[model samples]
Target: MLTNDRIVLKILKNNKRRPLSAYDILDKFLRIKRIQPATVYRSLKNLLEQNLVHRINQSNKYIVSSENSHENDVTTIVVCEKCNDYEEINVNKFKMSLAYNILDLKNFDLNDFSVEISSQCKNCKT
Candidate 1:
């Protein structure tokens, strides 16, 4: 891994349970190194392209990809609105079913996909 990769990875690893925006990561890194916003964004872009990180569109944040997940795998992210935590779930069977349904439409090309579900976490419910 490169220097920027290492630094960004460290920040993400430290906050693995929650998704963070680029600015959030940059703020945490500023105390340690004289880093810039572009540097953090570049590192995040690199990590995202490499599939080492996953972007949560709903929250506009990023999280470390799960250990068992691959770039091609179907991923479902469940986000807690109350706690701002997220978890990744594999839905391979559902993916296959959805793909078949889409294929039956007979003109739609299935490329890439991800699902994000938002709800209050268990702790927050209590």
Candidate 2:
């Protein structure tokens, strides 16, 4: 891996449980490296393109991608609004049916989609 990739990976690994924005990652790296926002964003973009990271659309944050995730699989990320915790769940079977139904109705080709649901987590609710 490249230097930027290593740095980004280290940051993600260090905060594996929660998602982080590019600014958050940049802030953390500032202590050890004199990095800029563009550098952090570039690294994050590369990681996202490579599927090493997953973006939570609702929260506008990124999390380490699960090793078990597949390129063709439809992954749904459920995030806790209160605690900011998230979990990725594969909804391939549901996605296939939903995609086909929508495509049949609209006559449009479906390429990619991401679903994010926000709710208070069990721990956060207690």
> Model 1 over residues 3-118: C-alpha lDDT tens digits?
98778888898899888898899999897888778999999999887878889998899898888985567778899988888888876745665765866766666566677889
lDDT of each: 0.82, 0.82
Question: Which lDDT value does model 1 have at 89?
Answer: 85
RMSD of 1: 2.5
Candidate 2: residue 125 Cα off by (Å): 2.4
RMSD of 2: 2.3
Summarize candidate 2's per-residue lDDT along 1-76 as a digit string, tens digits. 3498779978998999978888899999898789778998899888988878889887788898888887687777
Q: What is the TM-score of each candidate against the true structure?
A: 0.84, 0.85
Worst 10 residues of 2 by lDDT: 91-100
Give candidate 1's TM-score: 0.84
